[model samples]
Target: MKYLLKGAGLALLLGTTAAYANDGLMAEIAKPEQWAIPTGDYANTRYSTLDQINRDNVKDLRVAWTFSTGVLRGHEGSPLVIGDIMYVHTPFPNNVMALDLNNDGKILWRYEPQQDPNVIAVMCCDTVNRGLSYADGMIILPQADTTVVALDAQTGEVKWSTKIGDPAIGETLTMATMPVKDKVMVGISGGEYGVRGRVTALNLADGSEAWKAYSTGPDDEMLVDPENTMVLGKPIGADSSLNSWEGDQWKIGGGSIWGWFSYDPDLNLMYYGTGNPSTWNPSQRPGDNKWSMTIMARDVDTGMAKWFYQMTPHDEWDYDGVNENILTNQEIDGVERKLLTHFDRNGLAYTMDRETGELLVAEKFDPAVNWTTGVDMDPNSETYGRPAVVAEYSTAQNGEDENTTGICPAALGTKDMQPAAYSPKTNTFYVPTNHVCMDYEPFRVAYTAGQPYVGATLSMYPAPDSHGGMGNFIAWDNVEGKIKWSLPEQFSVWSGALATAGDIVFYGTLEGYLKAIDADSGEELYKFKTPSGIIGNVMTYQHGGKQYIGILSGVGGWAGIGLAAGLTNPNEGLGAVGGYASLSDYTELGGQLTVFELPGEPAAN
Candidate 1:
């Protein structure tokens, strides 16, 4: 019945939300009938009400076929298999392609936007696109230039393109993840240089700016300012954010929107996590910094602000609140209610009122750092460690490697590979995380659009016990606000998780092994290897009776740095971050799209 209701909601969404009803572009894309991407439909449930591939036979899974994508930079985008066709976007501009899933590795059509190669130089992350969004009959893509481009779903042709940012202004549009409609929400990156952050929604069909929201406001608008930025709670003159800097950091304040975005279509609302504040040094931006390190909920159509809850106030650990929010319903205190849950970078799992953005619970998901006693919502906002987390960062010239101060979750937790996916079968959300801490010291530097993120140095340390480590997969019950079960990984699992009807949860590890686990009890059921490492999104679909599982195997992503550095650590042997985790010790720069199905015959991709 819940599954049927979800389908009905998608069916209704197909016809309603006619605000951009021109060209029927969004109307014919098929009812929001399937879990097309990461958010699992327009709303980010992470839970699919379907259970075709239950626990019993999930162990029997095998490879179907492999499609080689010769060009590999960072494979983060999940393949969107719509009907018999699969649409995918690769790194850089104009790399979108449409492949036929009817036969293994068949190229139906490939469309490249052919934008200037210069744009690739501007991307903060390794030229990656999370995935393409489909609605009506068109596919929506955020190009390297921060422009939203619509592609014809069947032909893989561009329908329209709207520039979202000015690259010249140090503002670049590298949509880290796919955009969810209602909010058409997109986040900014370039945080290393103090670029201001924003997420905007445009009319889906016409690509017109519906509304725009900012992460950092004026001095009076600044929520957390160490300097006297405001006069009686209002904006005063002299923007100290500009004191040490050059370029737009003083203006935008580097609250990069580069996080996962999810939506709740039925409620006509969307949620997105915000990135860390600019210039890792806490003393610079002083106040709680408004929307940065926060989660925002807004109406999908009007793009009006609904509610926002800050995860970390005046965060100094470079911990961005940019993680996925799972929309689930659970009975709390005997009352069943709609709720949104997130395991934030602040080492906490939060359950909030989906419609009104109320923080019902903000429980520590990690015990490594207790920078704050707890969250308080009286007037409604976050209050950090009694006197605020001390970010005592000193200079190297003064002779120091940025003396480390222990901070929980290191620069990697709450949940990294898209964070905790929910499975309706067990009513649980599964997440992969890095359980570690770091002593981060600050260093001052000039702001450059395409340079490294300076201003704070990080010295990391492992957890004293096993509860937290470089990697963890935890099953959390939304109603309880607690961990149901957890399994540790050898390395940080950076791939987005997928829930299949196969009665299992599938996720890729950094070193290339895609593992399946019993959704009920944290039992390892199956695993396989890809070309390199799997740091992207893993998805599953069924066509022609055979169910299929697919994801990328690339090692150039964030995890590769440590994996590479670990390789040179003679003390650690040849085993790298994800080494020996079922993946062979090999460096295959080329990434291929591999799918697994029942041995012998190939399934429709």
Candidate 2:
């Protein structure tokens, strides 16, 4: 009763305090100075309020500074620039480096950890570094071994390292973007293998335990109350087979929070999405897994869940909900409400109530999705594909293939490069999409740690619809929760999002181009190719009467690396890669951080 009263009182205070800033995103869209707040403000829109380089003068934008990460493998880490400093991470051994964003990219300090070379053998995705975190004068780096390490933001010194879960127990993962707040919001990997899945949080100040929430369980350790009030977690068990398979697969369930997480301060909620299950065979872990493939709402301080709405229940497809959950409010069905949205790898455009976790609207965000007709609320709907146990490919006649139905959006969805960011001012969401498909052929396998990490093997084929290249920049509508406008490109969008007050949405392409698009309409405003491939998130900010935009230039990961070889000759849309994985030829490039600003001497250019 005491917790409830306190929660209600805090809610009432926030409800009344945000009245003036209630301009949809304004209430949450962070300021440029608060670049410390990664994902552009708390809502994680990746949008900036500074307008130093608006559309009319963005043409004058030129290079301001560039920093290189030396280990050139996969450059997916989104740089975090807070106050006067910027933090970056690299793939091998996962090192953390801090530089002065205000300087000409001068190295302020470097903190390298004695990481294990063996951890490399465990990562399911590319050996890449997504990013780190900064809050309370400290930097939080979520390492490959499922450990969250804190560093002094001013001086690159280790503050504390909290090894939350074991990567050996299926925890090897990366940021692909960086960590936000000191919220040690970490999750497990090994979904391809038979590892358990879950996400947890720890205090950054002294590495104390804050909260933990698992991916699968009705008898979950965490329980939440709607209306933004109470949250407590305790292990609970319930039938998950109705959503996953026909039997008791939850016994070894696999839905992880391995993608990205966002926040909404006004609502005081932290949002994170979970990944898909292992085996790709639905029969293994049957039923709609609880937090997996769902965007969950939890209180930042206590780690209590407020509400959760599953996007894909019992997702037979390899559609892990490992995308960024961006926060933005919109008017829908003639009603104005707060919005929680994401571009799902499941090929779905998901929008829900940020506070209650109710499905406000869900649609097919992709052009080629054949998994299911659409989102069905019923538990017994046979529309949800069966497990791979019934597959004809299996030697056993009764065995089958449930996931990987050869949809247009393969494991890569309508949007895979990163999460689509929105600009409330323009009322549009900026997103990246790949035009590709895969014919999934599932085979039984096992998880023996150093052995083949996945329990099942899948052979991928090409899509019939995509005419070559990957990526289409779309200007989406938050109001209607639909595509406002779109333009196709040859390369996949591997970088993060950048929305500026200057009426431009900045992002990068796999073919090494940092481009800008008109925020209101889907039109290319400017494009510049970097040294090699571009797979980093782009950010914009200002210091001494100048505006600058920046992103990393290197390509790795399935989003960029796999496409490199298949892109040599160029067939249709910008050399869409077929199936080439290693990028030894470009490793020497050592990913450069290119910063652009208005022409000097005469500032305006």
How well does each candidate superpose onto the true structure, as a TM-score?
A: 0.82, 0.83
Error of 2 at 195 (Å): 2.1
Q: Which residue ranges in model 1 land beyond 4 Å of their true spot?
A: 1-35, 176-183, 218-250, 376-402, 448-453, 467-469, 561-588, 600-605
| Residue 152 shift from truth in candidate 2, angstroms | 0.8
Residues 107-174, candidate 1: write the lDDT tens digits. Answer: 77777676767765455445666777776577788777777877778876777778878665556665
lDDT of 2 by residue, 126-164 (tens): 677677766656777777876678888888788888877
Off by over 4 Å in 2: 1-30, 101-103, 176-183, 218-248, 332-335, 377-405, 449-463, 561-577, 580-589, 601-605
lDDT of 1: 0.61
